[model samples]
Target: MEKTFKNLEIYKVKKAESVQEFYENLSLNRPGLTIPSLDTLYDVGHFNVFTRGNCGSTGPVSYNRKDYYKISLVIGEGILFYPDQQIVVDGPALLLTNPDVPYHWQAGSEAQSGYFCLFTENFIRNRNETLRETLFSRIKDHPVIHLSDAQATVFSEIFKKMMAEMDGEYIHKFDLLRNYIHLLTHEAVKICPVNEASKPTNASARLASQFIDLLERQFPIDSTDRVVELKTAHDFAAKLSVHVNHLNHAVKEVTGKTTSDHISRRIANEAIALLRYTEWNISEIGYCLGFEYPANFNIFFKKQTQSTPKAFRKV
Candidate 1:
């Protein structure tokens, strides 16, 4: 059996409390700066680097979905892992990790070195979601691209410039990182071909697939503009027009997990995303997630993740 991501001695890049926690391990967090909230459209996440043998991380990141979107320009040999795909490559490759996708990487060599910038949808929302939509459409499936040495240098320059911008005290520094991220993504589209996975072949598989999609449609909950109405397996079944037992059976048969399990896991993913990226108080966040009271959301989050919302946010 393939090892689950958490079942290995892998380096996990968990979420952070503030942007400073993101860079402090790199010896880069400036003292006396206030931590920013990721909840608002005006507030944006920042950039940082993760080098092998540093930050006590001995191996590559395990297969997982991050709460935020990431664009990593890896400069050494490594293997990229995904649920439906895996790619092993030589020197340089540009990789995108989306909140919706689960993936991991293991360095194939010790000389791993590169730059990666992490940002949220809020970061690009100010630009009117143009960059986010363009990059998403172009690279949603083909998130990795192998680059030649010279090509690597070109992308390298962009990331290097981002590092410099991050180090500088410009007020609009994050605004600038947004532009560099934009350029890096545009360059990736020019080099990679579109990749589409084949559709499922069986009825159980198709139903299970559709069920998963329906479950994920209500997510990130960036704001309280609307509330999630589907909070149970019955709700999802009703949406899919199937008996609860049938829905549960299809999901279990194809994914080896129950419908409730899928629902819970996706909810946990969204909870973590909001906790890490938003400034909404726990009650508002809970209401958005379909909980009627703050205490109930607290219990659910703690049960699903082994930590409370406040504690998880601090991590």
Candidate 2:
């Protein structure tokens, strides 16, 4: 079963009673800055801004373990970020993030120089369905981009326009802002290097895409459940409401892997990542991957990689 975005908690910040209160609250929990209703801009929902003084800082700022998707446009001094890799954004750069990924930033001390727009998954879905897929699938996979002089000028103009509209007294200023945001996202996508040829366009390809999407939702598949639930081609085929042969054919045609093969490989890959990245014990790790018995998980792990889970964890 695919998990819906609604299940994920969304946070926004609105009213701070006082600047000190806001900074104190944000330094403790950054998500408060974007989660709606906790502040005054509840009507705007899932969108908020933080200037220099709002979160008073004279030097670089670091936010550890904060989970949210943000688009930051640096207008003056650049910011340095260290996530899984090191990234630096000097002038007029856009930074995208999600909760699954962690990041910290070092900002320069200056006047109200840069702008950050934080949005939720709902905001992305409401704006454009495909935008979420494209962004989540590609943005972080590539390197940070620094806009050219011409691109920077265009982005600066758009930012200025948005600020003006946000400050305007017009009744439909938010609607206008929404359109400007769309334009901004479209421009960002234009620079991203997505492998268009790899994108599925045909009906079979669409089905395959949906299948992968569904598979990811049931993620962290445990070793025990792996043998019971999606163990056979017919099991997944039935869940997908397609004939076993057809499912197998589509899976092979689109991804060049059989249904069972894909499942096994995904489970193996996730096990390796967890072994390398986390300190969870073998039994706990087995439970996380859906295995009821540690012994069974060890057998499967050894069969796949010719190494015990402990040995694999060490390597």
TM per prediction: 0.56, 0.46
What is the C-alpha lDDT profile of model 2 across 1-315, one tens digit per residue? 012111322222222122234345666746545423533121123544543333334433444433235666665444444333456455666665553334555444344355665554333433113233544446544435577768867766777787777667999876676676677667776877565323555766666666666665555433433432454567677888888888778776655456776566456545665575567678876767657899988987777657788877665
Report the Cα lDDT for candidate 2: 0.55
Tens digits of per-residue lDDT, candidate 1, 55-117, equal 113444555555467777787766677665567757788888765555676665667677777
Alpha carbon lDDT of each predicted model: 0.67, 0.55
**Candidate with the greatest TM-score versus the true structure:** 1
How many angstroms is residue 144 displaced in model 2 relative to the true structure, after the best TM-score fit? Answer: 2.6
